[model samples]
Target chain A: MEQPEVAVAAGDTSDPLTGLRAVSSLRVLVESYELRQVEAALRAGMSWQEIADALGVTRQAVHKKYARRIDPTIAVPRRNRT
Target chain B: MSRLTDAVVLSQQIVVTATEEAYRVGHAELELDDLLVALTAVGGPAGDVLRSLGVTVDRARSAVAQVHADRLARAGVPAPPAQPRTLPRTGGGLPWSPRADRVLTAGQWDLRLVDDRRILRDLVREPSGFVAEVLAVLGLDAEGVLTALDAWVPTATAPSGALFSPDPRPWRTVTRRGWVPAAPAEVWSLVTDPARRTAWDPWYSAVEERADGVLAATLVGEAEGAKPVPPGFERQEVVPVAREEGRLVEWELRRPDRPGGAPVQRLAVALTPSGGGTRVDLTVRWLGVGGWRAVVGLLLRPVARLAWGQMLLAKHAGIARALR
Candidate 1:
């Protein structure tokens, strides 16, 4: 049996769906590192309001877009699922 | 090798006991219909009680049941007992005495719940951030594990002897690495789903259902060249401890080869939100198989956890991506 195409190319990290491709796996790894820049900006232990001002978005939008997603399933009530 | 196996077996037992007590003690026993009847019948104590709590009697009762079932399934009881085997219900047995052949000694832990905000702090914004974080902690390659950790989230908490205590057993536990994810929800979706467990877990062979809402999972060692799989092992998950926007997943382990041809393990995952990401807490315990010494176990845990954490990191990444 042949292995399925695990990647389009061996050396680079590019996804057809995401449109933008990283030059290499290392680049892909570092791409997300920049998100830490946003993270650092948000919380210097700063308030979401303060963070929102820095990002130039309303606090609510920031909370919605940037806030963590909880396990909504966590709020699901357990019962006899008929 | 036998010592390593024993460590896995013993630590799992203690986790099971402490985890069950956490959920069972805090739950309310009333069913939904019972609450409805109380709601209509009173300006009485029950109705007043409901109002005081700021929940309609019906909503309160239903919510309680939901939490109860979530807690049970999250406990991981569904994974092991999906098939009929001799494993006991509570967990695997462990003895403190070396000659007696038990796992971790003593029960009752100092475990507590992780507040919501604290967990959120560990989150990542990337599609596979939970998986990525898991890889970071597992010390896996950044590329492979980041996908998994990017979606990581806490499933449960069992107050291990994480801190110093007079009793050596709880205090001296094996190290379970920090589990993170790009998105905590994605991790919970992958782990809590009975079908997806085998995709990431190294120990389980396949996952199946034994009865309504009950799950059974077969366990097999995937190590290279390890032939003659140990006696039959199973995984079971009971009601989940908590499954909301954040998940507290409860799960247990079953090993048939041990003394009773059965031993046990347990786990919990919890999530907290921070900034644009989440903080996750993961707990695993060894139920049966006795005579665990902290010093002896400590020397082994770092290496063992690193190995398993790598596997989990990979799984978390792949599954989280799939979830997306």
Candidate 2:
């Protein structure tokens, strides 16, 4: 890959434009990583409560966000839980 | 019966795959790099060409990450962790970026069919330069890729008429069953005899047995309220491949003017005695073309199946009328 002609100093967060772009990129990266790990956990037959405990969040919060996204066949059942 | 051609089906698959690629990386809008990555996954001539040149999905995904990392590096921010290999199933649509839309619709200006290969060409010639940059990162160039694609010949070598066999895997089969007010032997005689078929079958205007034991028929194209003959097809030659006396008859239909190795449509009519009448089952297996069309067929299968169902309904009605 061809390198850009000019490179900013390492760990320099001085520039506002660069800082904002980096923030946006990092947010997208984190969201994608979270979705992937959640999918892997579901496929591995882990229940929602287990995943929530690992992420330090409530089971209901985790299930509400990812239940629709995950395939129903692979999703671990939530017995008698709202 | 439907106007959805193989090109249209293939294009739809490409766009859907590209959308998934965008969604996999948390992109709100689909871009050229997403399309390039998708081309590696959708099985078609373009995908085959890319794979032949060593552009596998894993390689393309890594190269795409490298491009994103390089862009972020210019901003003094370190690259994030690599994306996961398994893509998430996106529920809704992602709007296409302007550059991506432009590359997709560029083929409409030309008279050429907008197949995957055409889309690949348009991607190479896109003025936005994003796809070209990705190609550069992949150790390839537009000119080299195009040359390789142009020279690439598909390896489908199934012999002419060999696709007409009893194997129902590749072909799309449409079946309709109805009770005709006649005995099984009587219905079988009428269906097996070409002269009787012309009187009852709405699809055939005239049918005659040739010296080679095949039946040559003039197709009824949009006449007498019959279903229109598929475009580019004028005549149908039926070569009987299987027969059980007074029980079943299977004929493989081929277009006389079509090129050799083109898909042959198979028509099988099975008769059985039921409730003092003949239960006739009509099956039409169509477009058994083995290469890229098969891939496209898998994508738009429901559309083709529905169209075939409509035609079969009309034909079965005609058969019942004649039997009465």
Candidate 3:
């Protein structure tokens, strides 16, 4: 087993801004991953309402955004109020 | 004019030992583990400090070896490529890399005297350095070492002589802690939200969130009937450089440009969750001081501390009230 490196690099904390940049980048990646998962669910025969419930969003809201991409022939639905 | 003369022979020995260990591992750089092993072998004030903190030479050696073994296993490197002793120790005198040089330099500056313990203190503070690797295996961090160092009082005589005692510099750190009757998340929200801050914000009059998580704020000086802003000082940018939601927030305040450069003051607020409330620790540090200001600060440390305490008290009171 390889021992994990836990030491701070020589000048890692010299600049405080570096950590902030890292967090920001990580957040962007997280958002991208969430989007990818949602798209995959939609492509896997999951209904907009089901995806919306899993995401804590309204069915109509999910349909309005992803409906055309999920099923172009289906008519757009009005957003549902929370 | 060699400041390294205090226990120069001991220092040389430690360096050689560290180099030998680094060579044994086939690592060209003399890292913190090597230093730890060397320090352990020397067995002095630094060694005592390490022992007090539950660290030993054997422990350090084992930790370093474990890390190397893990790395080799992961990388599929051949086991013990015929020993590092076969290779020439790169760089005479243990050959400190720039990072090691910086660590030693920092130790000298911080301790104001070069000694084993001082070096140990500096090396332990390097979280991403080799010491950090060892510390991780030991279930410790830089902060843990710092806490231990603080609690430790030197007993044995320092090799640097009587004049080598650590002296107080002009620098001062003021840490004020307050309790807010809310969860850490709730308190963090109030603290970060400018709208909610209006009720108790003693530091900034206006705080606008800038691009990339920066905050532009007009700093508020003394309260009503207080002394005016000192001459040559102006309201400057305050950047929230690091933040851990509901936990830690570190900000930097840029000073007005001067000859050398603008000084930057650091402020960090840590929120620790307590019983149905949050404990907030706010620490302010003055960075970049030299020339006349340092001399003045040194002279007025007591007065400055009192003023800082008052300001922090007021701020804490305001926070408590707002939370209520």
Candidate 4:
């Protein structure tokens, strides 16, 4: 797979207008509350490793799924909450 | 260095496992079933997304893999990497046609190798700027196509416009819910009356009237708490649908917000008196094509679907509560 600069965004950011465009569709909407819950978990300081375990995935998998989302400035504590 | 890494090489592609329909409720992937589902979801955009990305795809993905074996092998991926492989065939049982075979050779779209686990493509339709243009970037290994994710894009037409043209983008999906035990007009009385409509609906604010019909004035409620009601998810033109009065009672939605948001509905509800009760036949008239429409459609569809289920169940319950 070729590397695309703007292309790097698909897996992460979707155009704000992309969601704005969906407003016209009947059954479709932007992301759901369930997904927001996923984001909320991240904000609550839950590690992707722990989240993966709860979601039945490997730590690497969870981190891969959400690592891009982690704001580096937040200084997430790596220590396991358990 | 293109900020690209040797580690970014398409390590291997794995065949996606088939799962239940509910499994794919949130995400879009590129498996045979998923691709088929996507083709159905995006309708036109499925092909357009591929063509826009310059990736050659078809209703038959197996053959698509064979023709792209050189590229797949270069990335160290197999056709399916797993079971249930359906190879592609030509008119004479060949792999692919001569012209059909040329989609990948310097096509209009660019497929940039992202990493061992991703493949990115530039798909242009509505041109969502840098954020929305990139489609899936999957990884390939000894297996075939890894997890190919559909853009899960918003479906409203125009960069921004009303969804009133086409069928509801994502929400307001009208399925043929069977009729209940009541007359169409009788049920219409329960559903159409503004006060009564409010009685039965949690989302509908109230019912108003224009020259053509009565409007349900209510905020389309989200599931518990959903963000920005899904596309085509908003409500208006909501009424106890009746093509022929007293015979069928149903409901329809019009976006009036997004381009292509107008619904081409084909559902009619009927009430047949039976055993002292009414039996209703709720049928779908038609649904607009999915695709760019559905990207936004899914968001709205959830609430539309959920609200329908809730409205009906609640409507019945509310009516029952009122009757008692």
The best candidate in terms of TM-score: 2
Candidate order (TM-score): 2, 3, 1, 4
Query: Candidate order by lDDT, highest to lowest?
Result: 2, 3, 1, 4
Which is superior by DockQ, 1 or 3? 1
Candidate 1 per-residue lDDT, tens place, A1-82, comes to 1123323232223433222222221232232232344445543456667766876779777555433321111211231111
DockQ scores of all models, one per candidate: 0.02, 0.11, 0.01, 0.03
Indicate the docking level reached by candidate 4.
incorrect
- By lDDT, the best candidate is 2
Task: Report the C-alpha lDDT of model 2 over A1-82, residue by residue, as the tens digit.
Answer: 2234334443456776555545545555566667668878988878899999999999999877666544333536653212
- Cα deviation at B213, candidate 2, in Å, is 42
Stretches of model 1 off by over 4 angstroms after superposition: A1-82, B1-182, B220-228, B234-245, B256-263, B291-324
Which window of ten consecutive residues has the lowest lDDT sum in model 1 chain B? B79-88
Per-residue lDDT tens digits for candidate 1, residues B215-304, read: 666555433212346444334344333344444555544443343543344555555442222334445545334555545556777775
Residue B101, model 2: Cα distance from true site in angstroms = 1.2
Comparing 1 and 4 by TM-score, which wins? Answer: 1
> Whole-model Cα lDDT per candidate?
0.36, 0.67, 0.56, 0.35
Candidate with more favorable, higher DockQ: 2 or 3: 2
The CAPRI quality class of candidate 3 comes to incorrect
State which candidate has the highest DockQ. 2
Docking class of 2: incorrect
Cα lDDT for residue B166, model 3? 26
The digit string of per-residue lDDT tens for model 3 on B189-217 reads 87777566545656665667767666656
